[model samples]
Target: MRDSAPLTPPVLPDRPRRAARPLLAAGLGRRDAYLLTLPLAALSLLPSWLGGPPDAFLRVALPALLAVLAGAFVALLLGRWPLERVLMGLLTGLWLGLLGRVAFVLLAPGSAPIDALALCGTWIPVLLAAHVWMLGRAAGRVASQLALGAFVLVLLVCGALHPAFALNTVGNVVMQILLASLVALGGQRSGLLRLRREVREQRLGADLTGLGDSLTGLPDGRAARRWLRQASPRRLEGLAVAVITIDQFHHVEATHGEAFAGCLMAHVARALEGALGDDDTLSRLGPSELAALLRVPDDRAARAACERLRLRVASRPLDGVNVTVSMGIAVYGGEGDGLTLLAGAQDALDDVRDAGGNRARLGEARRTVVEDMTPELRSA
Candidate 1:
């Protein structure tokens, strides 16, 4: 019953975590932020049409058509459909709006007139809000302040010309700007937080393959650093760090091509993985270097582990090409830190490579020799 209780808890958390992911992903996406515009546009058009002239179709159709075209232009801007081209689309749409309004006034000559100024004023706020939303952070901040200034100017002019509708216009402009700001800032913040939380949770969970190399399935250098930082204290009690590097790896890359080199690395990685024990961690520290942290009782055991790995790799044939690995081993009992320990192992590996590859050197008290360094080191 006690054994079963531990197993049951692990299994229970998996189902709930899996179910919650899709729910969070579907909430508050980029397109949902622009949905309110459709309804707002419809409401803006409807009131003017209801109290319009007998030739209401001619008066309303042009404004409605321009509004639709303007809205489509805003969508293209948001979609980032080529800046050079979308700017042209915006100019064409603006010209069409003006031409349509002029055509409506000329054709629908009537005593019960359409207030074209009121229609333009209402549509301007909606378009301004959309433009502000599409602008980048630095530009958007400036644009928002400019929009507020424009609204204030409109309010002062409209108050003198149309006192009865000025208050309504002021309210509509404020509402549209406020809505756009909330959608742009609040929606972006919430979505970013949700995405970050998801990634962090995944990092903490069982599936940690993301922390490793895609091709080799070995923990990457970042992961290696993190593990070393965490395990350095325990390593001081007695642990081994070994850095294994393939000799003349760039020559292999240049001769065989990148794809073949990648395959060879993957093959080598598998052979190294097979040599590691349950307590050992294998990591890809560089393009041609693999680092392993081994759990050992004493210095001999650490040396044995390094030799075992080196022999295992040398014996393996990758795609009919014979391969060999050189290793440098360092014990952590008398080290400054984990990084220092890794550097010591790298120094030892360099010594072996200089003496000719396919060998393992354990606990040599020397820093990395500059003359013994490869072309990559000399260039750096």
Candidate 2:
């Protein structure tokens, strides 16, 4: 016997939101950052070609261009491998280091080589900040802190070795670091907001579609149709659809109130569902009709299943009233679609109602002999 408790609609659990990480907050993905390198590198070198001597410019520009091209080729080869991001970061660091050295040489030609090297070291902090903004904070935080420590060390060394040059450039270096920090923070916040909005929209869409039937707590006709459309050909083999209609459902509603009729229908749905196998699906197609999709070996098995369902419904009493269901079964013969099969089942159900209303009828070219049901057999 089935459980006597009333059926309740399924409640979907709240989906846990992922904590926003600093790494994912950055809108720029690894691939986008890698692809943007070429254009940015070209723009950075424009100053050297426009203002510096051609011989000195080529010495730096040619090597940097070759390195950029080689890095791009390697990144493309790696595709989506995890190591690709690490390789790209290394390549960017090398390129920035080269540019820093060139900048010190061109801007402070007469300064001592050691002083120029100290100034060039300032590029490390800038590179770290750029990394945080482009890829993510988690990827670059450790390196950024180390670079900052190195920057402070360089500042102290320059102060001891060449106090005048250190004093002159300290303000400029501090300003550059501050600017990079601001940019990184802004990018993270913006990306986080966009990510949150996208998650909310996805949750809303899922909630809208996941609700099934309100009364019987079973899937409705729409869900049944969707399942039929999505089911594969292998699964459809030997599949049969049975449409069950309660006999004199309108008279039951008229005699008892509408509320009692609704309760009776829910009870019938549960009884029918309990009779079906776990592999089969039962859905409420209308107020008086429910549809079952069954996997049977042949017409005999399908007929037996429908008869079992009919007996199960008639055996139970709802609010002191006996109920009996008439079923129509149609099997898939590998020719027509789900809609056609459903229509055939409905046609068979009409035939069952026409010939007294309690027995199950098989609909197809090879129809099974249906036994006649006398007025004494049907429910009141």
Candidate 3:
């Protein structure tokens, strides 16, 4: 028995996996980084005020004040401008400020060669590392990687040009690179986790609200009712609600199977959805009924739309079986609420079903026939 058993282990089927989220792809809006500029600008001036001449305070103070003011102005433009554009402007301003400092050091009469080189070695790496971290957090992974590579190249060139200080410069460069890599990885992981949490929360909210029908993939009745309740009176004006029911759906289901009935319902949903305008909303209201919220100019337009839907459904053949629908429309007169309008449409649907099926009716002073029953027509 043991010799007859298979030598290899059985291969199990692979389970479908969710797509992995891209690292550092979360959007960083203006609100996340707007306040960072003010503090960073103030801190950039600290070294200048501490080590420079007595008049250095006046020289650095004006530029720092200007930078803070510019950051403030950018903050005011947050909602008007795109976040990426705003971040680009801020990064440009920072680089320009660093270049100005480099020029100041180079032009000073008493400054030694070592002092200028030291300034570059210290501040260049600091500024580049800060930028790398910021870009990782705000811009994205590509930008952060680009900055990281550029800074490494610059450091390598500096080390080659100055052989005497190469040891210390190379060490500093290594430490900075490690620090930057760690910071970027940590920030990206945190951002990915936050994004995942937000997505899960949104899915939960949707499930709780029952806003979508799992079978038909259309908005469910709850969503339709919610929209009706939330819509303003001005918006509700000239709007119409039409309830559509699959004629003799129970009999069809009994004749066919439940699975076929479900497929038929989905087919009818697609047909009704295709006939609707861009502004109209289609929803599944029951097992065999769907509802449409149409934005029409008048009752005549609403009736025409319902008639078109009726014709569209009857014209299509699903699995060689003829299908027909009954529709009831209730136009909003700027008086009652959304639920009331839905109730009126439901009442009209009952009337249409009572007097034969395969027609459209308008809910008004009297149940008005928008389309007459035509049982002689068959789907091709």
RMSD from true fold, candidate 3? 20.8
State the lDDT of candidate 3 residue by residue for 1-380, as single tens digits.
Answer: 00011112347999899677653365444454555455665665565557666345237645665665476556645667755555656655654554444444333445443543444345544544455355454455555456456555644554565544445543454455447555655666677668755653453233324467878867788888887787788878878999999998999999998999999999999898788886777888999999988989876677667878888888898999999998888998877888889998898888888878787777863223222323222110
Error of 2 at 227 (Å): 2.0
Q: What's the true lDDT of residue 277 in model 1?
A: 79
Regions of model 3 farther than 4 Å from truth: 1-210, 366-380
Per-prediction backbone clash count: 0, 0, 0
- Predicted candidate 2, C-alpha RMSD: 20.4
Per-residue error (Å), model 3, residue 371: 14
C-alpha RMSD in Å of predicted model 1 compared with the true structure: 15.0
RMSD (Å) of each candidate, 1 decimal: 15.0, 20.4, 20.8
- lDDT of candidate 2 at residue 375, scale 0 to 100: 28
Each candidate: what lDDT?
0.61, 0.65, 0.66
Error of 2 at 313 (Å): 0.5
TM-scores for the candidates: 0.42, 0.42, 0.44
Shift of residue 311 alpha carbon in model 1, Å: 1.4
* Highest-scoring model, TM-score: 3
Kindly list the per-residue Cα lDDT of model 1 for residues 79-191, writing each as its tens digit. Answer: 75654355335434543463344334323345222355445444544544454345544454455456545545544554556555435644454345445544554555466
What candidate 2 gets wrong by more than 4 Å, as runs, is 1-211, 368-380
